[model samples]
Each structure stands twice: as structure tokens, then as C-alpha cells.
Target: MTAPKAWSYSALSTYVSVCTLKYFFRYVANLEPERSFSRMYFGLAIHAGLEAAYRAWKPDAPAPVGVAKKVFMDDLTIRLEDPMIEFKKGETPEGLLTEGMAVLDVWAKEARYEEIISTESEFTVPLVHPGTGEIFERGLKGWFDLVVKDPDTGEPVVVDFKTTARRFSGDKLEADLQIRVYSYAIRQLYGLDRANLRLDVLVRNKKPVFQRLEVSQDSEGDARLFELVRAAGRGVEAGVFWPNDGSIWCGGCPFTQACARWHDNPDALRSHSEK
Candidate 1:
């Protein structure tokens, strides 16, 4: 079986669910899902639009948000999906745009675009496999939405972009394991002890609400994230792919068929040959 290049939230989440499923999907599955899930496409469109707008953003003469959103959706070259590709897709592009519009509108109005220090910065931190000396082989990788400086203090801050239709909540952001992981990676990349993390959540509705959260730096939190990743690495090394209690998210899982087969016909799952 092929091993993962690195452990991230996505992989860790999958590992909790059937390691066999993760192994199959990452190393054996021939047919991949069209989109991540039914609701994911909307976020993708919003991310693309935001990237296009901010990548070319200028503080003096800000680019028109409407124009960027329109051009990104209308122009075939800039779209997330191919114009000519015909298939039974997970979600309609138009539907996603309709849902994402209001949130984007909120973001355009309130976000501190003028304070951007950098955009779309990629960071990779070395990760060691629990049983092997493969720090580079399996490293942590993620993208920071924006790195901006506080106008008052000129302190560097990491900004993460997100959108949700539900009521705003900082509880999740405050406890998010990613914050710690990203904090460690960002600190390592910048060589700073105190790095600021911000969560910019844009709520979707007629009257959208903008929620900004400044995540604190926690050494214990950072240690916890690394421990979780290290545990995952151990699981991968031992070929221990047991399913976690993931029924809450199993509704959206892509390996339901294989999972069902494991229950109904256990022998079929044991067959080494990939279909």
C-alpha cells in the first residue's frame, strides 16, 4: 500500500473513519468523486473569486468586487469547472454561486483588504513518520489565506477566510486543531515566537454578518496538534486502519459502498485485487 506524503486535517479525519477507506481512496481507488461533496463547490467558487480579487488588489484603487465575482464565474477560463465537460456533477455551479453571493458581498464590504501584507502563502513543515526517519517524506502542508499587518501596531497576523450560513460562533475557531498546527508551521516559517491568527467568517443571508476572531498563541495547543499528527503517523506505519466513530459525518462519506460491502460481504473487502 502507498503511504501518505503528509498528515493534515483531511487525512486525520479520514483515518478516524476507516483507514482502509483512506488507503483505498488515496492509494487504490481508480474512480474519484467529481467534487469533494455536494456543498464543497460553493466554497471553492468563493475562494477562487476572493483569490482573483485580492491577488490583483491595490489599496489606492481597489478592484471592483462585483467585476471580479462576475468575471470569475462568467469567463470559462476562470471557472472552476470546464464548460464542455458533461457529467452528473455533485452540485450545480449556479446553485453554489447563489448561496455564496451574500457572504462574498459581506466580505467585500467589511474585510480589512487594505492591511494585506501577503496573499496565498504556502507553508510546509517537516513531519517525521513514527517508525521511520522520513521528515521530508511526510510533512505538514497548508495554505494561508492572507498575512496582514495590524494598522495600529504593525504586527504581522495570519488571516483565514471562511463562509457559513449558520449563526456566527468563535467556539469552534478557538478550539480548532488547525489553528495550533498552522501556528506552529507559520512560526517555523517566519521564525517568530508570537504569531497572530485570525479567523474571518462571513455569514450568508440578506444581512450578512462578519465575524473576526484573533486566535491566541498556545504552546500546549501546538504540542497537542503535533501529538495528534504523530499518532496518525504511528497508525499509518502499523497499518492500523480502524474506523473511528464517524457516523456524524458518514452521510457525506464517499466510501459508503465499500463500507457497506465490508459489513454485508466481509470476504469481498479482504480481496487484495482492486476493482
Candidate 2:
């Protein structure tokens, strides 16, 4: 007979925190239309599904697995079956699955069996800036999903995988701020030498897209990113959340109703609500 799976408490807490932060970031940063349960659940589903695929590929990697599982189980009890089969069919790999599973395992046991996985691993919460001492008090903390050194230059490349419901038009300038913020944090934590980063967007029903962004140690782009961070900080302090209308993001936004109400009119909000 097979033994029952154990729980990991610390991992579960981190998962809840991360999921909460993601929702907070979108709401506070005005990155999305508004915050709603559907948006949260959808985001969690995509994140979990992709992560499960990664874990199925590399079960030994604790960090990714722990993170992935936490997000999946916390937001949804959905499990990934035949992750290997999903990957072979040209689906995005789930490098974040085990982390997600670890999170769920803890939560389930804690609530049901009263068991938890205890460990000393430091789980960095992405609430404040890891560098520059800037406090995104209202904005959620951000972190890179993956980082690898360039084979030749040994420069670290920060990579983040995003799963969206729609397809990205392969436009770098119009990319999400989360990716750019992540690049900024990576530079600050690892120094300018490791600021090179790339953003990978995996559309659930479309082709995968890649965007390479270089954060030079002394480049104007880096300066801009820092400025944006400062701007975000100020917005957080001022309680400002300017929704981007006509961004093609509102259609899938869960907070559309609230955003429309706040904007004072449906027409005003619709101007930028194209998806």
C-alpha cells in the first residue's frame, strides 16, 4: 500500500501570500481593470496548470515545485494529470508545479490532518523592493521566475513565464510591467552584471511568445525602470490606481464592474477595454 502524502505549512503560507500579492499588485498598480474572484481564480488556474507541467518534467527541483503547487492548490484544488503528456503535445512545461503541490499539501494537511512540513528554507516575499530600499507598500512584491547564467559571458538572464488567456502580439514595448519590474529587482539584487532578462508569455490557446529585455547597468532603460518603480511607490502612497482602458485586458478583467463604476461611466472605461 502507498503511504499518504505529507503536508508543508510554511510552503502553504507563502503560496497564500504570493497569490494575494498578485491580486493586490493588479489592483493597486492599475495593471488590470479591477479585482474580482473570477480574475483571481483564472490567474491561479493558468499559473497552476503551467507549473504542474514543469514539476512533472523535473520532480527533483524543490523551489519551482513548491512555488507552483502552492499557487495551484491555494487558489484551486485542480490537479495536473499526465503533465508529461501535456508537454509532449507542445504545451508549456510546468516548472512551477512541485512548488505549488508543496503548498497545497501543507494546506490540506493543516486543515484536515493537522500535519505540516517544517523547513528552514527562506521564502522571499515579493512585497518590497529587494533593491533600492523602495517600499511598494501597496504594490505587491515581485520576483523572477527563473535565472540562468549565459554560457559564454556568464551574465545572469532573468526569465519569467506568464500564462494569459489571450495571445500577445509580440510587442515588447507593450509588455506587462511585472516583467520589467522583475528585471529591475534582479539587477538590484544581483547587480548590473546580471540584469539581462527575458519575458516569456505562454498563451493557453495560442503560440508561445518571447521578449528579450536588456537592463544595462548604465542604460537609460534601467533608469526608466527605477523611475517607474518610484512612480509606482508614489501611486501606492497616494492611493492611485489608474486603470488602462482600451488595453485589450479589460475583457478578461474580473474587476470590470468596479472599475467602470470608479471611472464614472461605462463608455470611459470601454475606451481602453478592448481585448
Candidate 3:
């Protein structure tokens, strides 16, 4: 069992919570996915497009509507060249480009940031327990999608963009681990007690819908995040990884073949065992 040098929000949530087996496969064995998901490609393109638009934005000027669409199409075209990208049923590259353009159109019209503070801001900070002042060996690292000054409050707000099949529920918004981690990071970086967080969600529908959701943030969740990261690290050290069978995302996972072969192969586990 071994602990990583750092943990990202995706590591704590997607790898640890989603499936610990995935953590082992990715981190310990360092195995690449058999194929990439089209959704991942689509999201990359969308983010790139949004980043471009936001970069081109000027104070009190019109939104970069055309720039957003063009960049999305260009990025999508480049990503589509990868033959290993697996598209969902009835999802074509052409269809995705069309949908992405439409989504960006909605974003260009609806998304507003009075003052763009930063885009793609990367941060790495020590993971400190709030309750006991315990500092962990593994640090936390992640990138902020966008940061802007709020029109009403004139305070820096962290905004993350998501392209999803449906809008997130209130409970989901409140419970999001990313928010907790981001809140913790904001405090560490800015020395601010409370972090203002927002999610700009793009819903995939016949006609796309854009939603701006504000998440309640405070120092309360920081301790929980610290504990969660600690537990995940402990689990990794103990080599406690098991497939999350019957999960909805299992079918789309790139590790299906490797997961199926795990039980028959003690060598795989031994490869990462503490010497």
C-alpha cells in the first residue's frame, strides 16, 4: 500500500468514491484507459471554447459569441481525430459539434462575469485538518475553471462549468465535494474565511438550458474534506480496492477488462505491494 504525493478533487471524488479499484488501476499500476470516452472529449472542447470566449471578453463589451462557437468547432474537430474515443449510442462527432455549438450559444448569451479575475487558475496547497491542525503528507491540487468579481457583492467568486445531461439538484449542489475542496483551497490561497462558489451548468436537451447555481460555502466542510482525503490515502496504503459492480458508470469504464481479470491475477496486486 502506498499514498500519493498529492490528491486532486477528482482523485478524492471520482477515483475514491466512484470506485477504489479505479484508483488502484490508475495510480498504483499506472495503467492507461483502453479507450477514451467521447463525453470526455466533448467536455474538453466545450471548456476550451468557454476559456477562449472568456479570455477574449472585455469589460462592458458584448460577449464573444462567435469566438466561442468557432473555437468549440475547431477543438472538437481536432479531438475527433482520435480513433480510441468511444461515443455513446447514436452520438456522432458531427452531432456533438452541432450540440456543442448550440450549448456555447446559450452560454455566450447567459453567462456573465462583471469582472473576469482569472481563468484556469491552478492551485496546489497542503491538506490541513481544521479540527486538530494536522497536516497530511499528500497535498491537494486542482484548477479553477473561472474566477470573477460578482456584480452585486464585488467579491471574488469561483465558478465551475459543467456540461451534463440534466441540471443538478439542490441537494447535489450542496453536497458537492468539489465545493468543499474549493472552499478549503480558497481559504488557503486568499486567506478568506468564506468562499463564494457558483456552478454554471449546461443541460443537454433538445434545446439546451443554461443554469447558474450558487453554492453555500463556509469553513464547516473543510474538516470533512480533510478526513475524506485522509481515509482515501489510508485505503490506498492498505490496498483496499474493489470493483464497484452494477454501478451505472461501470459500462462506460475503460477498466472493465482489467477489472474482470483481477481476481485471477495475484501478480497485479503484488505489483503495488509495499516491499
Candidate 4:
């Protein structure tokens, strides 16, 4: 069977669908809002501001430049260098700084900002049925952030970056499934023997944290991906869209009002007694 069109970052519907699915999963799983609002907002601002600054300063760099041209330029020369000086202990010279700056710029601007804009076009990817030879196309396809060749075994490794408000000290974090899904996608697309997946969380309040997991050749990560896909499919099938009440995360969700209304009155009837 022929492969379908791959999902691009430019599509709006895909973005909305992914976000909706994530909200549903979080609600179903009863994820807690562990971080404070101040910390979350601060982390967002810091990440955005840093990215904007990097874009402005590095015009020739492959990284994304922000909408504000002057600010983007100013950030490159001034703000970008400060991090290298303070954090890297002056180890990041001009060349290394430029390279790292370019990488982050692409990540921040293309991966973060441009993704939010709505697009008319949709992208799709092909998934082969396990039992049948039928190839089904799925919407919203994207690649893992990083892929590196392992120095020891010469195998490919998938690395993903995550920005958060705080650090996770344990061997595994709560959202490792996201990385596992990305790794699974990478494996399917590349047809590689196996991928050693790693997650690097850039904690805004402190130093960055790294977590590594070697996905087994067997169907472990694939199972997780299937679970996510099935859960999302079930949500769509059952029309079980409801807001999880009293979840602090609901405050930030765009569909909170719709969910709340639905939860309060699934019949869509207004409360006449209140009036």
C-alpha cells in the first residue's frame, strides 16, 4: 500500500486535534497540576524571550526569527551570549555558540511559535495494519526532534527536548509516554533496528534534566503508542468530551467552558430555576 501524506507543522486542524486529545487523556488520567501558575507562565516567558532574542541576533543562522525584527536581532548578540558565558563557563566559543544558537532558534520559532498558527492544509502518514496488509493513513505526522548515531553501536538514537517549570529527579518522569510515542514514530518511519530514546527537559527554574530509555526491539514502545492511539480513537467514538472539573489545568485549556457546560448539563438545557 502507498504511504499517505505526512503531517506538517503548518496544519491547524492537526494542532487542534492533538491538543484536544491531550486534554482528554489528561482528564481521563487525572493528571495533577503540580506546578504553580507563576512558575508555568514564567517558564513560558523565559523560553519565548530567549528564543526571540536568539532570532534577532543571529540573522544568518538557520534558527527562526521572531515577528519583531529588531527585538529578534538584539536578542542574538546580547541575551544569547550571556547564557553561554554564565552557564557554559565561557566554554561555548563563537562557533559553538552560533551552532547552538541556531539549533535553539529553529526549535523555538518553528517548533513553538509557527506551530500555533492555524493552517488550511492537512498532512497524513501511513500506518500498516498488524494483522492485515491494509495500509491506513493517519493525520498529524511529525518527526522526532533529534536523531543521533550511537558512537558505540552505530545505531540511531532519538532525542527530544521538553521545556518545563521544574526538574524531575527520578529515572522516569510522568510524561515519558510522549517521548515513547515519538520514538515509535521514528522507528516506523526509518525502519531502523532499534532506537535508544532520550528526553531532555530544560527546566526554567533550574538546570536542565536528562532521562534516557532504550526501547526494546520487541513491541514495548509500540504498545504504548497503540494505547494512546486507541484511547484517542475511543474518545472520538464515544463522544465522551467532558471537562474534568476542579483540575487546575482546566484554567489554561481553551475548551474548558464547553466541557464545563457539558458536564453541568449533558442534555444542553439551561437551568430555569436559577432565573
Highest TM-score, which number?
3
Model 2 regions lying over 4 Å from their true place:
1-43, 49-140, 165-176, 206-218, 239-247, 260-275
Could you tell me the TM-score of candidate 3? 0.95
Error of 1 at 71 (Å): 4.9
Order by lDDT, highest first = 3, 1, 4, 2
Query: Tens digits of per-residue lDDT for model 1 on 1-275?
Result: 33467666556656643354545445444436433443444555666677777777767665458755764465423344544333235546565566566666767777545567778887777753334334545677778888887787687788887766665667776566667667767776776776679887776655778788788674546555656676766655554443433656555555556555554644443353322
What is the C-alpha lDDT profile of model 2 across 14-117, one tens digit per residue?
12222322233343334543333332444556455434434343323333434545456554544333221222233222433433343334332322111111
How many clashes show up in model 3?
Answer: 0
User: lDDT value for candidate 4?
Assistant: 0.42
Candidate 3, run of 10 with poorest lDDT: 266-275
List TM-score per model, in order. 0.76, 0.45, 0.95, 0.49
Error of 1 at 208 (Å): 3.3
Per-residue lDDT tens digits of candidate 3, residues 1-275? Answer: 66778888887886656888877787788798888888888888888888888999887888888888888899889989988889889999889999998898888788654688899999999988888999998989999999888788777899898888887776776668888888889878888878999888888888999988887577888887888888888887777788889998687778888989988975667667664
- lDDT (Cα) of model 1: 0.62
Alpha carbon RMSD to native, model 3? 1.5
